[model samples]
Target chain A: MTDVNSVRPQARAETSVRPEEVLLPPVDVIEDAAGITLFADLPGVSRDRLGVHIEGDSLTIEGRILLPAPEGLEPIHTEVGLAVYRRVFTLSKELDPDRVAAEFNQGVLKLRIPKVEHAQPRRIAVQVA
Target chain B: MFYRSLFPRDVLAELDRLQRGMQQQGDVSPSIRGTGRGGYPAMNVGSTAQSVEIHAFAPGLDPASLDVQLDKGVLTIAGERPGVLPPKEAPATVHIDERFSGRFRRVVTLPDDVDPNAVSARYTDGVLHVSVQRRAAAQPRRINVV
Candidate 1:
Protein backbone atom coordinates (compact mmCIF):
# COMPACT_ATOMS: atom_id res chain seq x y z
CA MET A 1 0.00 0.00 0.00
CA THR A 2 1.10 3.58 -0.58
CA ASP A 3 0.48 4.39 3.04
CA VAL A 4 2.79 1.58 4.12
CA ASN A 5 5.59 2.85 1.93
CA SER A 6 5.14 6.38 3.24
CA VAL A 7 5.27 5.24 6.87
CA ARG A 8 8.33 2.99 6.51
CA PRO A 9 11.61 4.74 7.23
CA GLN A 10 14.75 4.45 5.11
CA ALA A 11 17.95 2.61 6.00
CA ARG A 12 20.10 4.18 8.74
CA ALA A 13 23.21 6.23 7.95
CA GLU A 14 26.42 5.87 9.99
CA THR A 15 28.37 9.11 10.48
CA SER A 16 30.36 8.65 13.68
CA VAL A 17 34.02 7.83 14.21
CA ARG A 18 35.76 6.13 17.11
CA PRO A 19 38.76 3.92 17.80
CA GLU A 20 36.65 0.88 18.58
CA GLU A 21 34.18 -0.52 16.11
CA VAL A 22 30.63 0.81 16.15
CA LEU A 23 28.05 -1.94 16.01
CA LEU A 24 24.58 -1.65 14.53
CA PRO A 25 22.29 -3.33 16.99
CA PRO A 26 19.62 -5.56 15.53
CA VAL A 27 16.23 -3.88 15.41
CA ASP A 28 12.61 -4.77 14.66
CA VAL A 29 10.10 -2.20 13.43
CA ILE A 30 6.39 -2.99 13.39
CA GLU A 31 3.68 -0.62 12.21
CA ASP A 32 0.02 -1.02 13.07
CA ALA A 33 -3.03 1.14 12.56
CA ALA A 34 -2.13 3.28 15.54
CA GLY A 35 1.62 3.75 15.11
CA ILE A 36 4.98 2.06 14.81
CA THR A 37 6.89 0.28 17.56
CA LEU A 38 10.66 -0.22 17.36
CA PHE A 39 12.62 -2.82 19.32
CA ALA A 40 16.40 -2.79 19.58
CA ASP A 41 18.70 -5.31 21.29
CA LEU A 42 21.52 -3.59 23.17
CA PRO A 43 23.11 -5.93 25.63
CA GLY A 44 25.43 -4.81 28.46
CA VAL A 45 24.19 -1.22 28.17
CA SER A 46 22.81 0.30 31.37
CA ARG A 47 20.00 2.82 31.54
CA ASP A 48 22.36 5.72 32.09
CA ARG A 49 24.56 4.80 29.16
CA LEU A 50 21.69 4.59 26.67
CA GLY A 51 20.65 7.71 24.75
CA VAL A 52 17.75 8.25 22.35
CA HIS A 53 17.52 11.42 20.34
CA ILE A 54 15.01 12.87 17.86
CA GLU A 55 16.10 15.74 15.68
CA GLY A 56 13.92 16.93 12.81
CA ASP A 57 12.87 13.74 10.99
CA SER A 58 15.89 11.75 12.15
CA LEU A 59 15.87 9.38 15.12
CA THR A 60 19.09 8.27 16.75
CA ILE A 61 19.78 5.54 19.27
CA GLU A 62 23.22 5.26 20.80
CA GLY A 63 24.68 3.32 23.71
CA ARG A 64 27.95 1.94 24.96
CA ILE A 65 28.58 -1.31 26.80
CA LEU A 66 29.55 -0.73 30.43
CA LEU A 67 30.63 -4.24 31.40
CA PRO A 68 34.40 -4.40 31.61
CA ALA A 69 36.65 -7.19 32.80
CA PRO A 70 37.63 -7.05 36.45
CA GLU A 71 41.12 -5.98 37.43
CA GLY A 72 43.95 -8.53 37.09
CA LEU A 73 42.08 -10.36 34.37
CA GLU A 74 43.69 -11.02 31.00
CA PRO A 75 41.69 -12.03 27.99
CA ILE A 76 42.54 -15.52 26.90
CA HIS A 77 39.82 -15.75 24.25
CA THR A 78 37.50 -12.96 23.19
CA GLU A 79 34.79 -12.94 20.54
CA VAL A 80 33.04 -9.65 21.39
CA GLY A 81 35.17 -6.57 21.90
CA LEU A 82 34.13 -3.43 23.71
CA ALA A 83 32.28 -1.39 21.09
CA VAL A 84 29.61 1.26 20.69
CA TYR A 85 26.08 0.78 19.37
CA ARG A 86 24.64 3.51 17.16
CA ARG A 87 21.82 3.69 14.61
CA VAL A 88 19.79 6.47 13.02
CA PHE A 89 16.43 6.24 11.29
CA THR A 90 14.45 8.79 9.33
CA LEU A 91 10.93 9.06 10.71
CA SER A 92 7.89 9.53 8.49
CA LYS A 93 6.13 12.85 8.43
CA GLU A 94 2.89 11.26 9.58
CA LEU A 95 4.46 10.11 12.84
CA ASP A 96 4.33 12.30 15.95
CA PRO A 97 7.74 12.51 17.60
CA ASP A 98 6.55 14.61 20.52
CA ARG A 99 4.32 11.79 21.79
CA VAL A 100 6.86 9.01 21.49
CA ALA A 101 7.20 6.62 24.43
CA ALA A 102 10.22 4.51 25.31
CA GLU A 103 10.98 1.63 27.68
CA PHE A 104 14.13 -0.28 28.45
CA ASN A 105 14.30 -3.76 29.98
CA GLN A 106 16.81 -6.58 29.92
CA GLY A 107 19.07 -4.52 27.64
CA VAL A 108 16.31 -4.07 25.10
CA LEU A 109 14.94 -0.68 24.03
CA LYS A 110 11.33 -0.31 22.92
CA LEU A 111 10.08 2.88 21.29
CA ARG A 112 6.49 3.60 20.32
CA ILE A 113 5.74 6.42 17.90
CA PRO A 114 2.11 7.25 17.28
CA LYS A 115 0.74 8.72 14.10
CA VAL A 116 -0.65 12.23 14.09
CA GLU A 117 -4.40 12.56 14.64
CA HIS A 118 -5.08 13.54 11.02
CA ALA A 119 -3.02 10.60 9.76
CA GLN A 120 -4.81 7.97 11.85
CA PRO A 121 -7.72 5.94 10.55
CA ARG A 122 -11.23 7.19 11.15
CA ARG A 123 -14.73 5.87 10.50
CA ILE A 124 -17.30 7.98 8.72
CA ALA A 125 -21.00 7.82 9.74
CA VAL A 126 -23.50 7.35 6.88
CA GLN A 127 -26.95 8.99 6.98
CA VAL A 128 -30.02 8.32 4.83
CA ALA A 129 -31.00 11.18 2.54
CA MET B 1 -5.65 -33.00 -16.55
CA PHE B 2 -2.23 -31.44 -17.08
CA TYR B 3 1.02 -32.93 -15.88
CA ARG B 4 3.39 -30.76 -13.86
CA SER B 5 7.19 -30.76 -14.13
CA LEU B 6 9.17 -32.87 -11.68
CA PHE B 7 11.22 -29.95 -10.33
CA PRO B 8 8.80 -27.13 -9.64
CA ARG B 9 10.14 -23.59 -9.28
CA ASP B 10 8.41 -23.00 -5.94
CA VAL B 11 9.83 -26.25 -4.55
CA LEU B 12 13.33 -25.22 -5.58
CA ALA B 13 12.82 -21.80 -4.06
CA GLU B 14 11.69 -23.34 -0.78
CA LEU B 15 14.79 -25.56 -0.69
CA ASP B 16 17.02 -22.53 -1.24
CA ARG B 17 15.34 -20.67 1.57
CA LEU B 18 15.86 -23.61 3.93
CA GLN B 19 19.55 -23.81 3.04
CA ARG B 20 20.08 -20.10 3.65
CA GLY B 21 18.34 -20.33 7.03
CA MET B 22 20.53 -23.22 8.11
CA GLN B 23 23.70 -21.40 7.10
CA GLN B 24 22.64 -18.31 9.01
CA GLN B 25 22.04 -20.38 12.12
CA GLY B 26 25.54 -21.88 12.08
CA ASP B 27 27.61 -18.81 11.12
CA VAL B 28 29.80 -18.79 14.21
CA SER B 29 33.58 -19.11 13.81
CA PRO B 30 36.10 -19.10 16.62
CA SER B 31 38.31 -16.01 16.50
CA ILE B 32 39.77 -13.47 18.95
CA ARG B 33 39.03 -10.36 16.89
CA GLY B 34 35.24 -10.65 17.19
CA THR B 35 34.73 -10.80 13.43
CA GLY B 36 31.03 -9.98 13.88
CA ARG B 37 29.80 -13.07 12.10
CA GLY B 38 29.19 -15.18 15.21
CA GLY B 39 25.64 -16.17 15.88
CA TYR B 40 23.45 -14.81 18.67
CA PRO B 41 24.84 -13.69 22.05
CA ALA B 42 28.45 -12.87 21.23
CA MET B 43 30.80 -13.95 24.04
CA ASN B 44 34.11 -12.97 25.59
CA VAL B 45 36.24 -15.31 27.73
CA GLY B 46 38.94 -13.99 30.05
CA SER B 47 40.94 -15.44 32.87
CA THR B 48 42.65 -14.22 36.03
CA ALA B 49 45.06 -16.01 38.30
CA GLN B 50 42.20 -16.98 40.58
CA SER B 51 39.19 -17.33 38.27
CA VAL B 52 38.05 -17.52 34.66
CA GLU B 53 35.32 -15.09 33.62
CA ILE B 54 32.97 -15.40 30.64
CA HIS B 55 30.46 -12.79 29.51
CA ALA B 56 27.63 -13.43 27.04
CA PHE B 57 25.80 -10.49 25.49
CA ALA B 58 22.16 -11.57 25.34
CA PRO B 59 19.32 -9.16 25.80
CA GLY B 60 15.52 -9.47 26.19
CA LEU B 61 15.54 -12.69 28.13
CA ASP B 62 14.12 -13.61 31.53
CA PRO B 63 16.88 -14.40 34.03
CA ALA B 64 15.07 -17.54 35.19
CA SER B 65 14.96 -18.91 31.67
CA LEU B 66 18.76 -19.11 31.26
CA ASP B 67 20.52 -22.44 31.70
CA VAL B 68 24.18 -22.57 32.70
CA GLN B 69 25.85 -25.92 33.25
CA LEU B 70 29.44 -27.08 33.50
CA ASP B 71 30.34 -30.71 33.10
CA LYS B 72 33.38 -32.66 31.97
CA GLY B 73 35.35 -29.46 31.32
CA VAL B 74 32.67 -28.08 29.05
CA LEU B 75 30.55 -25.07 29.95
CA THR B 76 27.17 -24.64 28.28
CA ILE B 77 24.96 -21.57 28.18
CA ALA B 78 21.49 -22.02 26.72
CA GLY B 79 18.46 -19.79 26.56
CA GLU B 80 15.53 -18.73 24.37
CA ARG B 81 14.53 -15.20 23.34
CA PRO B 82 10.87 -14.76 22.62
CA GLY B 83 10.01 -13.07 19.34
CA VAL B 84 8.69 -9.51 19.55
CA LEU B 85 7.09 -9.29 16.14
CA PRO B 86 3.40 -8.71 15.74
CA PRO B 87 1.05 -11.50 14.71
CA LYS B 88 0.79 -12.36 11.04
CA GLU B 89 -2.87 -11.50 10.76
CA ALA B 90 -2.36 -8.06 12.28
CA PRO B 91 -2.51 -5.18 9.83
CA ALA B 92 1.10 -4.31 10.55
CA THR B 93 4.00 -3.86 8.15
CA VAL B 94 7.43 -4.83 9.39
CA HIS B 95 10.10 -2.61 7.89
CA ILE B 96 13.10 -4.23 9.52
CA ASP B 97 13.41 -7.38 11.62
CA GLU B 98 16.98 -8.18 12.58
CA ARG B 99 16.90 -9.19 16.24
CA PHE B 100 17.55 -12.87 16.99
CA SER B 101 14.91 -15.12 18.53
CA GLY B 102 14.33 -18.78 19.42
CA ARG B 103 16.58 -21.27 21.23
CA PHE B 104 20.35 -20.58 21.27
CA ARG B 105 23.16 -22.45 23.01
CA ARG B 106 26.91 -21.78 23.22
CA VAL B 107 29.49 -24.22 24.61
CA VAL B 108 33.01 -23.42 25.82
CA THR B 109 35.74 -25.84 26.90
CA LEU B 110 37.39 -24.93 30.19
CA PRO B 111 40.96 -25.62 31.14
CA ASP B 112 41.80 -28.61 33.31
CA ASP B 113 42.95 -26.42 36.19
CA VAL B 114 39.55 -24.87 36.74
CA ASP B 115 37.53 -25.88 39.81
CA PRO B 116 34.06 -26.73 38.59
CA ASN B 117 32.68 -26.74 42.12
CA ALA B 118 33.43 -23.04 42.55
CA VAL B 119 31.56 -21.78 39.49
CA SER B 120 29.07 -18.96 39.91
CA ALA B 121 26.74 -17.30 37.41
CA ARG B 122 24.86 -14.01 37.50
CA TYR B 123 22.59 -12.30 34.96
CA THR B 124 22.20 -8.54 35.08
CA ASP B 125 21.38 -5.88 32.50
CA GLY B 126 20.83 -8.66 29.99
CA VAL B 127 24.47 -9.77 30.24
CA LEU B 128 25.31 -13.21 31.60
CA HIS B 129 28.56 -13.43 33.53
CA VAL B 130 29.96 -16.80 34.59
CA SER B 131 33.06 -17.18 36.74
CA VAL B 132 34.94 -20.39 37.44
CA GLN B 133 37.66 -20.42 39.99
CA ARG B 134 40.99 -22.04 39.26
CA ARG B 135 42.65 -24.57 41.54
CA ALA B 136 45.11 -23.22 44.09
CA ALA B 137 47.93 -25.35 42.75
CA ALA B 138 47.57 -23.82 39.30
CA GLN B 139 47.95 -20.24 40.52
CA PRO B 140 51.34 -18.56 40.09
CA ARG B 141 53.37 -17.76 43.20
CA ARG B 142 56.19 -15.28 43.80
CA ILE B 143 59.58 -16.72 44.76
CA ASN B 144 61.97 -14.90 47.13
CA VAL B 145 65.59 -14.34 46.06
CA VAL B 146 68.15 -15.24 48.73
Candidate 2:
Protein backbone atom coordinates (compact mmCIF):
# COMPACT_ATOMS: atom_id res chain seq x y z
CA MET A 1 0.00 0.00 0.00
CA THR A 2 2.82 2.39 0.79
CA ASP A 3 4.50 1.68 -2.52
CA VAL A 4 1.30 2.35 -4.42
CA ASN A 5 0.62 5.61 -2.63
CA SER A 6 4.16 6.82 -3.18
CA VAL A 7 3.93 6.15 -6.93
CA ARG A 8 0.44 7.54 -7.40
CA PRO A 9 1.42 11.20 -7.56
CA GLN A 10 4.21 10.53 -10.04
CA ALA A 11 1.83 8.66 -12.31
CA ARG A 12 -0.74 11.45 -12.19
CA ALA A 13 1.97 13.91 -13.14
CA GLU A 14 3.32 11.69 -15.91
CA THR A 15 2.86 14.38 -18.57
CA SER A 16 4.45 17.08 -16.38
CA VAL A 17 1.49 19.39 -16.97
CA ARG A 18 1.85 22.99 -15.86
CA PRO A 19 -0.45 25.00 -13.62
CA GLU A 20 -1.93 26.96 -16.48
CA GLU A 21 -5.00 25.70 -18.32
CA VAL A 22 -3.40 23.55 -20.99
CA LEU A 23 -5.56 21.11 -22.85
CA LEU A 24 -4.15 17.61 -22.47
CA PRO A 25 -5.22 15.77 -25.56
CA PRO A 26 -6.20 12.15 -25.13
CA VAL A 27 -3.59 9.64 -26.20
CA ASP A 28 -3.35 5.92 -26.89
CA VAL A 29 -0.21 3.82 -26.63
CA ILE A 30 0.14 0.30 -28.00
CA GLU A 31 3.18 -1.88 -27.37
CA ASP A 32 4.18 -4.98 -29.21
CA ALA A 33 7.24 -7.18 -29.15
CA ALA A 34 8.80 -5.12 -31.92
CA GLY A 35 8.16 -1.59 -30.63
CA ILE A 36 5.51 0.86 -29.43
CA THR A 37 3.06 3.10 -31.25
CA LEU A 38 1.45 6.26 -29.87
CA PHE A 39 -1.66 8.02 -31.09
CA ALA A 40 -2.80 11.49 -30.02
CA ASP A 41 -6.07 13.23 -30.92
CA LEU A 42 -5.50 16.92 -31.73
CA PRO A 43 -8.60 18.41 -33.27
CA GLY A 44 -8.46 21.84 -34.98
CA VAL A 45 -4.65 21.62 -35.23
CA SER A 46 -3.10 21.93 -38.64
CA ARG A 47 0.12 20.32 -39.82
CA ASP A 48 1.98 23.61 -39.79
CA ARG A 49 0.96 24.35 -36.21
CA LEU A 50 2.22 21.02 -34.80
CA GLY A 51 5.68 20.51 -33.31
CA VAL A 52 7.29 17.24 -32.28
CA HIS A 53 10.65 17.26 -30.57
CA ILE A 54 12.97 14.69 -29.03
CA GLU A 55 15.95 15.47 -26.83
CA GLY A 56 17.90 12.83 -24.92
CA ASP A 57 15.16 10.40 -23.81
CA SER A 58 12.39 12.98 -23.56
CA LEU A 59 9.72 13.20 -26.27
CA THR A 60 7.43 16.21 -26.60
CA ILE A 61 4.45 17.01 -28.76
CA GLU A 62 2.96 20.51 -28.96
CA GLY A 63 0.20 21.92 -31.10
CA ARG A 64 -1.79 25.14 -31.26
CA ILE A 65 -5.40 25.32 -32.44
CA LEU A 66 -6.59 28.79 -33.38
CA LEU A 67 -10.26 29.10 -34.21
CA PRO A 68 -10.86 31.76 -36.81
CA ALA A 69 -13.63 34.22 -35.99
CA PRO A 70 -14.40 36.41 -38.96
CA GLU A 71 -14.53 40.16 -38.43
CA GLY A 72 -17.67 41.43 -36.69
CA LEU A 73 -18.52 37.91 -35.49
CA GLU A 74 -19.53 37.64 -31.88
CA PRO A 75 -19.46 34.39 -30.00
CA ILE A 76 -23.03 33.72 -28.95
CA HIS A 77 -22.27 30.14 -27.82
CA THR A 78 -18.95 28.65 -26.71
CA GLU A 79 -18.06 25.33 -25.15
CA VAL A 80 -14.36 24.68 -25.70
CA GLY A 81 -11.98 27.60 -25.26
CA LEU A 82 -8.77 25.59 -25.18
CA ALA A 83 -6.18 26.58 -27.79
CA VAL A 84 -3.00 24.65 -26.97
CA TYR A 85 -2.07 20.99 -26.55
CA ARG A 86 1.19 19.80 -25.01
CA ARG A 87 2.39 16.43 -23.73
CA VAL A 88 5.74 14.91 -22.86
CA PHE A 89 6.95 11.37 -22.24
CA THR A 90 10.20 9.84 -21.11
CA LEU A 91 11.11 7.09 -23.53
CA SER A 92 12.51 3.81 -22.31
CA LYS A 93 16.19 3.10 -22.94
CA GLU A 94 15.34 0.00 -24.96
CA LEU A 95 13.57 2.03 -27.62
CA ASP A 96 15.41 3.63 -30.60
CA PRO A 97 14.57 7.30 -30.72
CA ASP A 98 16.66 8.07 -33.75
CA ARG A 99 14.41 5.91 -35.93
CA VAL A 100 11.13 7.37 -34.76
CA ALA A 101 8.54 7.94 -37.44
CA ALA A 102 5.45 10.16 -37.27
CA GLU A 103 2.38 10.76 -39.41
CA PHE A 104 -0.55 13.14 -39.08
CA ASN A 105 -3.96 13.01 -40.69
CA GLN A 106 -7.44 14.23 -39.85
CA GLY A 107 -6.10 15.90 -36.69
CA VAL A 108 -4.58 12.70 -35.36
CA LEU A 109 -0.84 12.13 -34.88
CA LYS A 110 0.72 8.65 -34.93
CA LEU A 111 4.26 7.97 -33.73
CA ARG A 112 6.18 4.72 -34.07
CA ILE A 113 9.29 3.76 -32.13
CA PRO A 114 11.19 0.55 -32.66
CA LYS A 115 13.07 -1.46 -30.10
CA VAL A 116 16.82 -1.61 -30.15
CA GLU A 117 18.41 -4.63 -31.78
CA HIS A 118 19.76 -5.87 -28.44
CA ALA A 119 16.37 -5.48 -26.79
CA GLN A 120 14.47 -7.38 -29.54
CA PRO A 121 13.79 -11.06 -28.93
CA ARG A 122 15.78 -13.58 -30.92
CA ARG A 123 15.21 -17.29 -31.31
CA ILE A 124 18.48 -19.24 -30.69
CA ALA A 125 19.05 -22.58 -32.47
CA VAL A 126 20.23 -25.39 -30.26
CA GLN A 127 22.74 -27.91 -31.64
CA VAL A 128 21.61 -31.58 -31.66
CA ALA A 129 24.39 -33.88 -30.45
CA MET B 1 8.19 -7.38 -4.75
CA PHE B 2 4.70 -8.36 -3.66
CA TYR B 3 3.68 -4.72 -3.28
CA ARG B 4 5.18 -3.91 -6.69
CA SER B 5 3.14 -6.72 -8.20
CA LEU B 6 0.03 -5.41 -6.51
CA PHE B 7 0.23 -2.00 -8.29
CA PRO B 8 1.25 -2.54 -11.88
CA ARG B 9 0.95 0.03 -14.66
CA ASP B 10 -2.36 -1.48 -15.71
CA VAL B 11 -3.80 -0.78 -12.27
CA LEU B 12 -2.85 2.86 -12.55
CA ALA B 13 -4.39 2.98 -16.03
CA GLU B 14 -7.63 1.54 -14.65
CA LEU B 15 -7.69 4.23 -12.01
CA ASP B 16 -7.19 6.89 -14.64
CA ARG B 17 -10.10 5.52 -16.65
CA LEU B 18 -12.31 5.57 -13.60
CA GLN B 19 -11.39 9.18 -12.85
CA ARG B 20 -12.20 10.23 -16.40
CA GLY B 21 -15.55 8.44 -16.25
CA MET B 22 -16.46 10.25 -13.07
CA GLN B 23 -15.52 13.64 -14.50
CA GLN B 24 -17.55 12.99 -17.62
CA GLN B 25 -20.59 12.01 -15.59
CA GLY B 26 -20.35 15.31 -13.71
CA ASP B 27 -20.59 17.25 -16.98
CA VAL B 28 -23.86 15.70 -18.17
CA SER B 29 -26.15 18.17 -16.37
CA PRO B 30 -28.68 19.58 -18.78
CA SER B 31 -28.32 23.32 -19.34
CA ILE B 32 -30.55 25.67 -21.31
CA ARG B 33 -27.49 27.45 -22.72
CA GLY B 34 -26.67 24.35 -24.84
CA THR B 35 -23.34 23.45 -23.27
CA GLY B 36 -22.88 19.71 -23.61
CA ARG B 37 -21.47 17.73 -20.74
CA GLY B 38 -18.80 15.23 -21.75
CA GLY B 39 -20.07 15.37 -25.32
CA TYR B 40 -18.00 14.18 -28.26
CA PRO B 41 -16.98 16.71 -30.91
CA ALA B 42 -17.49 19.87 -28.88
CA MET B 43 -18.93 22.82 -30.78
CA ASN B 44 -18.95 26.63 -30.89
CA VAL B 45 -21.50 28.95 -32.50
CA GLY B 46 -20.96 32.59 -33.45
CA SER B 47 -22.90 35.13 -35.47
CA THR B 48 -21.61 37.93 -37.71
CA ALA B 49 -23.35 40.80 -39.39
CA GLN B 50 -24.40 38.64 -42.30
CA SER B 51 -23.99 35.00 -41.26
CA VAL B 52 -23.88 32.56 -38.39
CA GLU B 53 -20.87 30.22 -38.17
CA ILE B 54 -20.85 26.90 -36.32
CA HIS B 55 -17.66 24.91 -35.79
CA ALA B 56 -17.46 21.33 -34.54
CA PHE B 57 -14.06 19.95 -33.48
CA ALA B 58 -14.20 16.33 -34.60
CA PRO B 59 -11.08 14.52 -35.71
CA GLY B 60 -10.38 11.10 -37.29
CA LEU B 61 -13.48 11.16 -39.49
CA ASP B 62 -13.91 11.01 -43.26
CA PRO B 63 -15.60 14.03 -44.77
CA ALA B 64 -17.94 11.83 -46.80
CA SER B 65 -19.08 9.97 -43.71
CA LEU B 66 -20.30 13.12 -41.97
CA ASP B 67 -23.99 14.02 -42.21
CA VAL B 68 -25.21 17.60 -41.74
CA GLN B 69 -28.84 18.63 -41.74
CA LEU B 70 -30.70 21.91 -41.24
CA ASP B 71 -34.43 21.63 -40.61
CA LYS B 72 -36.55 24.53 -39.40
CA GLY B 73 -34.22 26.32 -36.93
CA VAL B 74 -32.17 23.33 -35.81
CA LEU B 75 -28.81 22.18 -37.20
CA THR B 76 -27.59 18.61 -36.70
CA ILE B 77 -24.15 17.09 -37.15
CA ALA B 78 -23.84 13.29 -37.12
CA GLY B 79 -20.88 11.05 -37.83
CA GLU B 80 -19.05 7.88 -36.82
CA ARG B 81 -15.43 7.57 -35.73
CA PRO B 82 -14.01 4.15 -36.43
CA GLY B 83 -12.25 2.36 -33.62
CA VAL B 84 -8.46 2.16 -33.99
CA LEU B 85 -7.79 -0.53 -31.47
CA PRO B 86 -6.11 -3.79 -32.31
CA PRO B 87 -8.01 -7.05 -32.59
CA LYS B 88 -8.41 -9.31 -29.60
CA GLU B 89 -6.17 -11.92 -31.14
CA ALA B 90 -3.38 -9.46 -31.86
CA PRO B 91 -0.21 -9.69 -29.80
CA ALA B 92 -0.23 -6.00 -29.00
CA THR B 93 -1.01 -4.58 -25.56
CA VAL B 94 -2.86 -1.26 -25.37
CA HIS B 95 -1.56 0.93 -22.56
CA ILE B 96 -4.06 3.75 -23.10
CA ASP B 97 -7.32 4.28 -24.97
CA GLU B 98 -8.60 7.79 -24.38
CA ARG B 99 -9.85 8.97 -27.76
CA PHE B 100 -13.62 8.95 -28.29
CA SER B 101 -14.89 6.55 -30.95
CA GLY B 102 -18.17 5.13 -32.30
CA ARG B 103 -21.16 7.23 -33.47
CA PHE B 104 -21.85 10.76 -32.27
CA ARG B 105 -24.36 13.50 -33.04
CA ARG B 106 -24.70 17.17 -31.99
CA VAL B 107 -27.71 19.42 -32.55
CA VAL B 108 -27.80 23.22 -32.39
CA THR B 109 -30.90 25.46 -32.63
CA LEU B 110 -30.24 28.49 -34.76
CA PRO B 111 -31.94 31.83 -34.51
CA ASP B 112 -35.11 32.54 -36.48
CA ASP B 113 -33.36 35.16 -38.61
CA VAL B 114 -31.13 32.63 -40.37
CA ASP B 115 -31.89 31.65 -43.97
CA PRO B 116 -32.16 27.89 -44.22
CA ASN B 117 -31.54 27.77 -47.96
CA ALA B 118 -28.34 29.80 -47.79
CA VAL B 119 -26.47 27.50 -45.39
CA SER B 120 -23.19 25.86 -46.39
CA ALA B 121 -21.13 23.18 -44.64
CA ARG B 122 -17.55 22.01 -45.13
CA TYR B 123 -15.10 19.68 -43.43
CA THR B 124 -11.40 20.64 -43.18
CA ASP B 125 -8.60 19.13 -41.09
CA GLY B 126 -11.18 17.13 -39.16
CA VAL B 127 -13.25 20.19 -38.20
CA LEU B 128 -16.77 20.58 -39.54
CA HIS B 129 -17.60 24.23 -40.23
CA VAL B 130 -21.17 25.25 -41.04
CA SER B 131 -22.10 28.77 -42.10
CA VAL B 132 -25.69 29.93 -42.34
CA GLN B 133 -26.52 33.27 -43.90
CA ARG B 134 -28.89 35.51 -42.03
CA ARG B 135 -31.98 37.04 -43.61
CA ALA B 136 -31.25 40.28 -45.47
CA ALA B 137 -33.86 42.18 -43.49
CA ALA B 138 -32.41 40.95 -40.22
CA GLN B 139 -29.04 42.54 -40.94
CA PRO B 140 -28.55 46.04 -39.57
CA ARG B 141 -28.36 48.82 -42.16
CA ARG B 142 -27.75 52.58 -42.06
CA ILE B 143 -30.16 55.04 -43.68
CA ASN B 144 -29.24 58.63 -44.61
CA VAL B 145 -31.63 61.33 -43.44
CA VAL B 146 -32.27 64.51 -45.51
Worst 10 residues of 1 chain B by lDDT: B28-37
- What are the models' TM-scores? 0.78, 0.79
Cα lDDT for residue B41, candidate 1: 84
Worst 10-residue lDDT window for candidate 2 chain B reads B26-35
Runs with alpha carbons beyond 4 Å of true place in candidate 2:
A1-20, A123-129, B1-34
Interface RMSD of each: 1.4, 1.4
Supply DockQ values for each candidate: 0.60, 0.59
lDDT of 1: 0.87
lDDT of 1 by residue, B25-74 (tens): 65466335333446778888899999999999999899899999999988
Off by over 4 Å in 1: A1-20, A123-129, B1-37
Query: Scoring model 1 with DockQ, what do you get?
Result: 0.60
All candidates' lDDT scores? 0.87, 0.87
